[model samples]
Target: MSHARRSVLVPSVMAFGFAFLYVPILAMIGYSFNNSRLVTVWDSANSPTLKWYSALWRNQQVLDAAWLSFRIALLNATGAAILGTLAGLVLARFGRFRGRTLFTALTTAPLVMPEVITGLSLLLLFVAMEQTIGWPAGRGVTTLTIAHITFSLSYVAVIVQSRLAGFDLSLEEAAMDLGARPVTVFLRITLPLIAPAIVSGWLLAFTLSWDDLVISQFVAGPGSSTLPMVIFSKVRLGVTPDINALATLMVLTVAVGVVIATVLLRRQERRRERDLRLAAGAD
Candidate 1:
C-alpha cells in the first residue's frame, strides 16, 4: 500500500476499534440518568433524570456488597504483595536451590490455570479443611479473601520478578560492604528500588479481587456477596437504571484514580530529572 493510504487506513481502523470497544460503555453511562422504570427504553420525555443515581445511594444491599468487596480487596492486595514479593525474591536471588523448578512452577501455576478449575479446587480444599479440622466452619469472607489472594499472588510475583530482573544488584552489595545487615540493606536499598513494582502489584491484586465473580461465587457464603456478585445477580433479573448508575459511578471513581496517579507520577518523574541534571552540573 502507498504510505499515504496506509496512514489514513491505519488511523481509520484504530478509530473504529476504539469506538467499537468504548461505545457500549459510553451508552451505559448515558442510560444511567434515564428516569424511566424500564432501563432499555430511553424515553426523552421522562429520561435523563438523576432518579436512579439517588436511588442507588439508598440501596443497602449494594452498599454492603461494595464495602465487603473493598475490604476483601484491600486485605487480599496486602497479603498477596507480601507473599508474592517473598516468593519472587527467592526465585530471583537464590539460584539453583533444591526444588527451585517445582517452586517456580507452583508460584506461576495460577496464572495459566482456568478460573473454574481454580475455584472448584479451592472449594474442595475448604470443604476438606472444614471437615477435618472444624476450623473455618463455613465459606465466608475469609475464605473468599484467601481464594483471591491465591490467584492474585501469582500476578504479584510475576510483576515483582520482572522488576527484580532489571534491578542493579550493585546497590545492595555496596550497602552490605558498608557493614549493613542483609535485612537492613533490603529495607533501605532493595525495597526502595522495588517500591513501584510492589505498589503496582498491590493495585493489580486489588483490581483482580474487586472484579472476581466465579471464584468468589464458589467460596462466598450467604449474606457475604461481593459487589461483582451483586451486580451479576441484578443483571440476570434484567437491566436496571440503578445498576447502570452504580457502574457509571465505579467508572468515574477508577478514572479519577488514574488521573491522580498519572499526575503524581509525572511530577515525580520531573523532580527526578531535575535532581539528576543538578547532580550532573555539580559534578
Candidate 2:
C-alpha cells in the first residue's frame, strides 16, 4: 500500500479498535446518569440525575455483597502476595533443588487450568477436608477467600519470578558479604527492590478475585454472594440504572488505581535510576 493510504488505514483501524473496546463502557457510563427508568432510553427532558447513585447508596443487598467481595479480595491479595513471593524466591534462587520441576509445575498449573476444573477440584477438596477433619464447618466467605487465594497466588508467583529473573544479585551478595544475614539482606535489600512487582501482583490478584464468578459459584455458600455474583443475578433480571451507576463507580475506582500504580511505579523507577547513577559516580 502507498504511505498515505497506509497511514489512513492505520489510524482508521486504531480508531475502530478503540471504539470497539471502549464504546460499551462509555455507553454504560452515559446510561448511569440517565433519568429514565429504562436503562437505554435518554430522558433528555429531565436527564442526568444522581437518582441511581443515591439509590445505589441505599441498596442494602448491593452494599453487603460489595463489602463481602472487598474483604475476600483483600484477603486473597495479601495471602497470595506473601505465598507467591516466597514461592518466587524459592524458584528463582533455590538453584534446581530436588523436586524443583514438580514444584514449579504445581505453582504455575493454575494459570493454564480451566476455572471450571479448579472450582470443581477445590469444592471436592473442601468437602473431603470438612468430612474428615470436621473443619471449616460449611462453605461461605472463608471458603470463597481460600478458593480465590488458591488460584490467585499463581499469578503473583509468575510476576514475582519474572521480576527476580533479571534482578541485580550483586546488591544481595554485597549485603551478605558485609556480614548481613540472609533474612536481613532480603528484608532490607531484595524486598525493597521488588516492591513494585509485588504491588502489581497484589492488584492483579485482587482484580481476579473481585471479578470471579464461576469459581465463586461452586465454593460459595447460599449467603456468601459476592459483588460479581449479585451483579450477574441482577443483570439476568434486567439492566437497571443503579447497576450502571455501580459499574461506573467501579470503573472510576479501577481507573484511579491504575493511575496511582503507574505513578508509584514511575517514582520507584526514577529513584532506582538515581541511586544507580550516584553509585556509579562514587565508584
Candidate 3:
C-alpha cells in the first residue's frame, strides 16, 4: 500500500480499536447513573440517577481502601524510582564489574515470575519472619508496599538504564572540562536528561501497585485492604451495578493521567528539538 493509504488505514484501524475498547467503558459510566440494579438495561424513564455516586460517597470501606492504596502506591513508586535509577546507573555506566551480570539477571527475573508464585512466596516469607522475629504482627499495607516495590524496582531499573545507555555522556565530560566538579556536572546535566525515564518508571510503578490483586491478596491481612481486593471479592460473590460505578471512576482517573503524561512528553520532545536546532544555528 502507498504510504498515505497506510497512514489512513492505520489510524482508521486504531480508531476502531479504541472505540471498541472505550465504548463499553462509556456504557458502564452511563450505567452507573442507572436507577435499576441491572447493568444491561438503559431505560431512560427510570434510568438516570446519581444515587450510586451519592452512596459511594458514604462508603467508608471503599474510601479507606482507596486512601491506603494511594499512599502505598506513592511510597512504593517513589522508593522504587530512587533505588532503581541508582542501580541502573551503576550497571549501565560502571560496566563489567564482578557479579554484575548475575545481579542484572536476578533483578529482571521478577518480571517473568508468575504473580501467584511471587505472592505465595512473599506470604510465606512474611509468615516465617513473624515466626522468627515476632514482628510485622500480620501482613498489611507495609508488607504490600514492600512486595510492590520489589517488582517495581526491576521495572524502573530497566527503563532508566536503557535511557542512560543512549544518552550523551559528552555533556558530562564537557562540564568537567569547563572546571565544574563531577557532582555539579551530574546534578546540572545528567539528572535533567534522565528525568523523563525516572518519571515514566514512577508512573508505571504507581499503576502496578494500585492495580495489583494477587500479591495484595496474599500479603494483606485483617483490615488492610486495597481497592482491587475489594472489587475481586465483590465480583466473586456476584455482579453489582456498583462495580460498574467504581470501574467508571477508575477509568476516568487513568485516562486523565495518561493524557496529561502524553501531552507533557510531546512538549518535552518539541522543546528538545527546538533547542537542538538553535544550537546548530549558533555554530
Candidate whose lDDT is highest = 2
- Which is better, 1 or 2, measured by lDDT? 2
Q: Each prediction's TM-score against the native?
A: 0.91, 0.94, 0.89
Clashing pairs in 3: none
The positional error of residue 245 in candidate 1, measured at the CA in angstroms, is 0.6
lDDT of 3 by residue, 102-202 (tens): 98887789888999999999989999999999877787878998999998899999999999999867888889999999789778987888898899899
Return the lDDT, model 3, position 260: 98
Of the two candidates 1 and 2, the one with more favorable TM-score, higher being better, is 2
Off by over 4 Å in 3: 1-16, 177-182
User: Across residues 89-183, which tens digit of lDDT does each residue of candidate 2 receive?
Assistant: 88887888889999999999999899999999999999999999987789998899999998999999889889988786898999999999999
- Whole-model alpha-carbon lDDT for candidate 3: 0.87
- Candidates by lDDT, descending order: 2, 1, 3
* Candidate closest to the true structure, highest TM-score: 2
